[model samples]
Target: MSNFLLQLSYLIGSITFIVGLKQLSSPDSARKGNLVAAFGMVLAIIGTILFHEHDGNKIGNIPWILGAMALGTVVGWMMAMKVKMTAMPQMVSFFNGMGGACAAIISIVEFNSHPDGAPGYLLVVFLGLIIGTVSFSGSIIAYGKLDDKIKDISSKALTYFNLLLLLAIFVVLGIAVASPEVFGHDVVWLLLGLSAAYGVLFVMPIGGADMPVVISLLNSFTGMAAAFGGFLYNNPVMLTGGILVGSAGTILTVLMCNAMNRSLLNVIIGSFGGGGASGKGADGEQVVKEISVTDTAILCAYAGKVTIVPGYGLAVAQAQHICHDLEKKLEDKGVEVSFAIHPVAGRMPGHMNVLLAEADVPYPKLVEMEDANPGMSSTDVVIVVGANDVVNPAAENDPSSPIYGMPVLKVWEAKNVIVMKRSMRAGYAGIENELFFHPKTKMLFGDAKDTLGKLVAEIKEL
Candidate 1:
C-alpha cells in the first residue's frame, strides 16, 4: 500500500509538472504555472522522503546530507533576500554554477562507486562531467564580469584558446577514465581541475554585451549536466527538470539573439554589441545630450499620460517598489500610468518584468512593445529607467549602428521623455544612444531607486 501511494504521488507530480510547464509558456498563465510547479515540487519532496528507505548497511551516514541541505537553505534564502535587481544577472549565473556543481559531484560519486566502469554509467558520467565543468566555470566568469568584479575583455584570440582548452580536457578525461587503475585515483582530481579551468577560459574573453547570451548558453549546459546525472541515476524527476531547463534556456538564447537582430553564430563569433551606426565616438564617449533630475521630474509630473520603462538599473536600485508608489500617485491625479516592457529588457529576457511583478505591480498595468508602440506618440511622458540598448533611436535612424534593424521602444515619438540613468556611457552594445540627445529628451542622471523615490515625493508637491 505504501509503495502504491508513492507511485501514485509520482504520477500525480509528473502530470502537474507537465501542465505547469505548458502554462508557463504564456504570460497570462505564468503565475498559475509557477504555483502549480511549486505544488508539484512539494509533492515530489514528500513522496521522496516517505518512500526512500536506505538500509543501514548500504547507507551508514545521513547527517552530512541533512547538514548540507540545512546550510544550503540558509545560504540560498539569505542571498535571495539580499541580492539586488541589478545583480540579478550575476545571481542567475551563480545558480547555473550551483546546478553544474551538483551534477559534477553526482558524477564523481557514481564513478567512485563503480570502479569497474559500466558502459552506460561511463557515458553518462562523461557527458555530465564535461557539461557540469563547463557550466560551473563559465558561469563564475560571467558572474564576475556582470558584478563588475572583473573588467570586460573582448579578444578574438580567446575563442581559439577556449577551443584548445576544451579539446585538451576531453583528451585528458578519455585517457584517465580508460586507465583509472593504472593512472590512480588522483587522475579524477586532475580531470576535474582541468575541466573547471577550461570552463573559466571559455568565458573569460567574452565582453559584457555578450554575457547574456553566454549566461543562457551556460544555463543549457547546466540542464544537460542535470539530464546526464538523471540518466546515470535513472531518476525521472531529475530528467524532467533537466529537459525543462534545457528547453527554456535554449528558447531564451534564441529570443535574446532576436532582440539584438543577430543570430547565435553572430553572438558567438561577432561578439556583437547592439548600438547605432555611429557607435563609440572618439575615446568611447557616446554622443548624447544630458540634463538634470529636477528638470526631468518636472517634465513627468506635468505630463498627461505617462509610460514607465524599467531595466536592470531599476532592479539594482531596489526601486521597483518606488516606481509602483510613483505610479499610484500619478494614477490618483488622473494620469494614465502604464509600463512598457521589452521582451529582452535587462540582463536576461523578461528580467525587468519579473522585478516589477515581484514588487506586486498590477499585471494589467504592464504593456508589451507591440501594444505600447502605438501609444508612444500619444504619450505625454516616457520614463526610461536604467535602460539603454532597448530604447536606442539609432536602431531606427542610424544605418551604421550594430543594432540598426532591431525594434526598440518608440520613446522618441513621445512629446516628452525622461531617462533616469547613471552616466552618459553607452549600453552593452557600446554604442551611443541617439535618443539621449533628442531635443525632447531629458536625462535624470542618478541612482534609479533614489530618483524614483524622489520623484514620488516631488509628485506629492504637485
Candidate 2:
C-alpha cells in the first residue's frame, strides 16, 4: 500500500512538471507554474522518504536527509532572494553546478557499492560520473565568466587542445568501461580528474557573448547526467524530472543558437567575441552627435512612435522600473511606446524581457527582434538604454567583425536614434558601435537609471 501511494505521488509530480513547463511558455503564468512544480517536487520528496523500501526494510537516514534538505532550502531561498538582476546568469550557473555535483556524487557512491556490477550498470555509472563532473566544472567556469571574474583565453591552439582533450576523455571512458578490472578503483578517480579538466578547458576559450548558449548547454549536460542517475536507480520521478530538464535545456540552447545566427559547432570552436578586434571606426577619429535630457524628452514626448531598446547596462543600473516610467510618460503624451528585445540581449536569454516584466510592462508591448525590425523605419524615435552590440551596425556592414553574421536590432533604421550610455566605451563584445557615428544617432550620456528618471520627470513637466 505504501509503495502504491509512492507511485501515485510520482505520477502526480510528473504531471505537475509537465503542466508547469507548459505554463512557463508565457510570462503571465510563469510564477504560478513555478509554484505548482515546486509543490509537486516537495510532495515527491516526502513520499519517497516515507515509503521507499529496499527488500523488507524502509529507507533509513531520515534525520540526516531532512537536515540536509532544510539546509539546502534555506541556502537556496536566501540566495534567490538576495541575487540582483544583473547577477542572475551567474547565480543560475552556480546553482546548476550544484545540481551536477550532486548527481556526480550519487554516481560515485553507487559505483563504490556495486563495483562488481554488470557491464550495463557500470556503463551507466561511468557516464553519469563523466557528464556530471564535466557539467559541474564547466558551469563554474561559465559562472566566473558571466560575473566578469574570468577572462576568455581564446586561441587557435587552445581550441585544438580542447578537441584533443575531449577525445582523450572518451578514450579513457571506453577503456575504463571495457576493462574495469584492469585499473581497479583508481580508474574512477582518473576519469573524474580528466572530465573536470576537459570541462574547465572547454569553457575557458568561449567568449563572453556566447555565455547564454554555454549556460544552456551546461544545464542540458546536468540534466543528462541526472537522467543517467535515474536510470541507475530505476526511479520514475527522478527519470521524468531529469528528462524534462534535459530536453527543455537542449531545446532552449538550440533556440538561442538560432537567435544568434550561429551554429552549435561554431559556438563551440569559433571562440568569438574575445574583444581584440577593433570596430569600423575605433581610431578615435569618428564624430558622434550628442543630445541633452530635455531634447530627449521633447523628442520622445512629441514623437508619433517611440521604441526602447534595453541591454546589459540597463540591468547593471537596475533601471527597468524607471525605464518603464519613461515609457508610460511618453505614452501619456500620445506617443506609442514599445520595447525592442533582442533574443541574446543582456547576459542571458529573455533577460530584457524578464527585467521589463518585473516593471509591470505589458507583454504585448515587448516586441521581439523579428517583429520590431519591420517597424524600425516607421518609428519616430528609437531610445537605446544601456544597449550596445544588439544595436550596432557592424553585424550587417562589416564582414571582418566577429559578430558580423549575428542578427542585431535595426534601431539604426529609425528616423532618430537616441543612445543612452555612460561613455564611448565598447560593449561586452569588446567592439565599438558603428551606430554611434551614424547621422541619425545621438548619444545621451548618463547612468541608465538616472537618465531614464530624468526623462520621466522632463516628460511629465511637458
Candidate 3:
C-alpha cells in the first residue's frame, strides 16, 4: 500500500512540475509557477521519506534528512534575501553548482556500493559522474568570472590543450564503460580529478561577453547530470524535472548564441572575445560631444516618441527603477515611451526585463530589438541609459570588429542619441562604440542613477 501511494505521489509531483513550468512562460504567472513547483517538491520529499521501500525494506532515518533539508532551506532563503540584483548571475551559478555536486556525489556513492553492475548501468553512472563534475567545476569558474575574481585567459595553445584534454577524457570514459571491473577504485577518483580540471579549462578561456551563453550551457550540463541520477534511482519526478531543465537550458543557450551572432561550436572552441583592446577610432582618437542634463531634459520632455535602451551598466548602478521613473515622467508629458531590451542585455537572458519588471514597469513598454529597430528613425529622442555594447553601431557598420555580426539596437537611426556613460572606456567586447562619435550623439557623463536623477529633476522643472 505504501509503495502504491508513493508511486501515486510521484505522478502528482510530475504533473505539478509540468504545470508549474508552463506557468513560468509568462512573467505574470512566474511567481505562482515557482510556488507550485516548490510545493510539489516538498510533497515529493515527504512521500519519499514516509513511504519509500527498497529491497523489501522500508527506508528509515527521519532526523538526519529533515535537519539537512532545514539547513539548506535556511541557507537558501538567506542568500536569496541578501543577494544584490547585480550579483544574481553569480548566485545562480553558485546554486547550479550545488545541484551538480549533489548529482555527482550520488553517482559516486552508488558506484562505490554497486561496482559490479551491468554494462549499461555502469555507463549511466559514468556519464553522471563526468557531467556532474564538469558542471560543478564549470559553474564555479563561471561564478568567479561573473564576480571579476578570475580574468579571461585565452590562447591558441590553450585551445589545443583543451581539445587534447577532452579527447583523453572520452578515451577514459570508453575504457570504464567497456570494462567496469578491470580498473581499481583509484581510477574513478582519477576520472573525477580530470573532469573537474577540464571544466575549469573549458570556462577559463571564454570571455565575459559570452558568459550568458556559457551559464546556460553549464546549466544544461547540470540538468543532464541530474537526469542520469534519476536514471540510476528510477525516480519519475527527478527524471521529468531533469529533462525539462536540460531541454530548456539547451534551447536558451542556442538562442543566446544566435543573439550574439556566434556559433555554439565556435564558442566551445574558445577562440573569441579575448583579443587585445579593441580599436577606439579609425585613427585612435575621436571628439566626444557632451550634453547638459538641462538640455537633454528639454529634448526628452518635448519629443514625440522616446525609447530607452538599458544594458549591464544599468544593472551595476541598480538604476532600473529610476529608468522606469524617467519613463513615467516622460509619458506624462505626452511622449510615447518604450524600453528597448536586447536579448543578451546585462549578463543573462531576460536580465533587463527582470530588472525593469521589479520597478513595476508595464509589460507593453518593453520592446525587443527587432521590433524597436523599425520605429527608431521616427522616434525623436533615444536615451541610452547605462548601456554600451548592445547599442554599439559597430555591429552594423564595422565588419572587422569583434561584435561586428551581432545585432544591436538601432538608436543611431534616431534624430538625436543621448548616451549615458561613465567614461570613454570600451564595452565588454572591448570595442569602441562608433555611435558615440556620431554627429547627433551626445554623451551624458556620470553614474547612471545620478545622471538619470539629474535628468529627472531637470525635466520636472521644465
For every model shown, the clashing-pair count is 4, 0, 0
Model 2 alpha-carbon miss at residue 56, Å: 2.9
Inter-residue clash pairs, candidate 1: 86-316, 276-401, 277-400, 277-401
For model 1, residues 1-462, the per-residue Cα lDDT tens digits are 655666677677777778888899998898899899879877866676667444522332457766786899899989978987667789989988999988888888877877568545676786798789889988998899888798665566777776787788777767665655666656567678878888887677666345788899999889889888768756677688787788888988888888767788776655554122364365445455666656656666777899998876786677888899989988888888999998777777778778888888998899999899999999999999888888988788878777778888999999888899988877866777778877888888889888788888878787
How well does candidate 1 score on lDDT at residue 118?
Answer: 56
Tens-digit lDDT string for candidate 2 (6-86): 899999999889889889787679889998899899899888999988786897988899899999999999999999877
Of the pair 2 and 3, which is ahead by lDDT? 2
Model 2 TM-score is: 0.96
**lDDT, each prediction:** 0.79, 0.89, 0.87
lDDT of 3 by residue, 186-227 (tens): 657878888999999999998756889989999998989988
Kindly report which residue pairs in candidate 2 clash with one another. none
By TM-score, the candidates rank as: 3, 2, 1
Candidate 1 global Cα RMSD: 3.6
Best by lDDT, which number? Answer: 2
